[model samples]
Target: MVYDLAIIGGGPSGITAGIYAARQKMKTVLIAKSFGGQMAHKTVDIENYPGFDKISGLDLIEKFENQLKGKNVEILSEELHAIVKENDSFKISFEDGKFINATAVIIAAGAKPRKLDVEGESEFLGRGVSYCTTCDGPLYQGKDIVIAGGGNAGFESAIFMQNYANKVYILEYGPEARADEENQKRANENGKIELIVSADIKKIQGSAFMEKVVYADRVTGEEKEIKAQGVFVQIGYSPASHIVEHLADLNQRKEIIVNHDTMETRTPGLYAAGDITDGFLKQVVVAAADGAKASMSAYKYLQSKNG
Candidate 1:
């Protein structure tokens, strides 16, 4: 069946888009391989989002789901393979060879964590190297671990590791940590966490699991290795825009470029939102707002076409 709107992604932005589009009485369908995106995987408590003083990522996602209780949005749990514009409608193909058609499409697929391309990193993915601290922090209880970033994500992971890891070292490639003042201060004050700047990661070495990290001190030209049981790579993220890259314009970072006001991409009938888009802020609230705007913009676009 051809839907009026096909929303790809089940994150905050995609959920919000589905909610708004369904409310407008459009035949909407939200498709995703997984729901909630990175925001749902965050172990830190969310305080910046309006309304609740503090909430967990999973709890926040539950709330977003609650908003979709009565909306006429069909949820599809399928991995997207490709999206092709067929004349006037979009043909969305799934990995299983199933396909669907839609008049307008909203791409809110969000992003995935960036990986450290150092040696032994891939070999010890589950055994030691991890992208999500909350998921793997417990495995290193009473052990030493090195965090591969000094950004807000890196700082937050370091602070969280204080609860389980015996010693946490934050290695940053830059001259200083890039986290905000508050997070930076918290990480510094945490007795268990040590923030190391100008440290370039060179390799991860271990026999069965990760045992230590090798790096070079940029300032002193000294190669150093830190003994650790685990390594948390909290560098950052990369947009999941490969499925639609051919259909939209992307910036240097590979993030989809969209009109700020309408969330519309250069391709007509194709809108983008959330971390997948080149938005200045990568917050949950901003993504939700973008979703709302994209849906409304699509409604207007469809109206113009109908006229």
Candidate 2:
């Protein structure tokens, strides 16, 4: 069946698009590998999303999911292998060799956390290593933990982890922390959070659970290991833009390039939103707003094409 709009993602961005498209009477179907995407895995406190003064990340995702329960949008739990333009429409291919066609496509596949790729990193995933600061930080209460990365994510993670962990140490490979001034200021003055600059993460070692984190000094060439029960890897994030790499123009970070005002890519009838696009911020509210904009743009494009 050919759909008027097919959204690729199940996160807040994708769901928001689906809701808006349904309200507009657009025949839309959503393909999501994991419902709620990575947001489902987050467990930390979220106080920014409107309405609730404070809530867990998972809880916020659940609330978003509930909003689409009675919507007219068709939701599918499947993996998308690729998206190819076919004249006026786009064809979506699944791993099982099935194809779905759509007049307009909105890509909101979300982003995945970058891994350290160090030894024992994968083996000790649930045991110690974690990517979601909100999901696993509370579990390591009263324990010493380390965070790798000096960006905003790292600093924010350090600030969050400090609430539960006895001591939080940020291991940054650069000479200084690159996080925002606010997070940096908070982390710098916090008694429980220590910033380790000019450090290179070498390996993660443990038997059943992570026992230590190893890093080298950039100039001294001396390696150091810290005793810790948990490690949060916050180097950066990689958007799920591989499927549309050829269909759209991607920046150096593999984020889809789109018009800021409309969220439309260089390719006509194709739009992108959320963490997958190179926008100002990667927040839930912003992504949902993008979803709304993309759907409106898609609706306008359809109207113009038919007229």
> Each model's RMSD to truth, in Å?
1.0, 2.5
What ranges in model 1 sit over 4 Å off? none
- Candidate 2 local lDDT, 110-219, one digit each (tens): 99999988888998899999998777889999999999998888888898888899999899988988897978888867599988999988888889899999889998
Q: Which candidate number would show the highest lDDT if scored against the true structure? A: 1
Lowest lDDT 10-residue stretch of candidate 2? 38-47
Q: Give Cα distance to truth, residue 241, candidate 2, Å.
A: 0.4
lDDT of 1 by residue, 3-117 (tens): 9899999999999999999889988999988888887777878999999999988899989988986778999988889999999999999877989999999999999999889
What candidate 2 gets wrong by more than 4 Å, as runs, is: 50-55, 138-142, 181-190
Clash count list over all predictions: 0, 3
Error of 1 at 166 (Å): 0.5
Clashing pairs in 2: 43-134, 43-135, 44-134
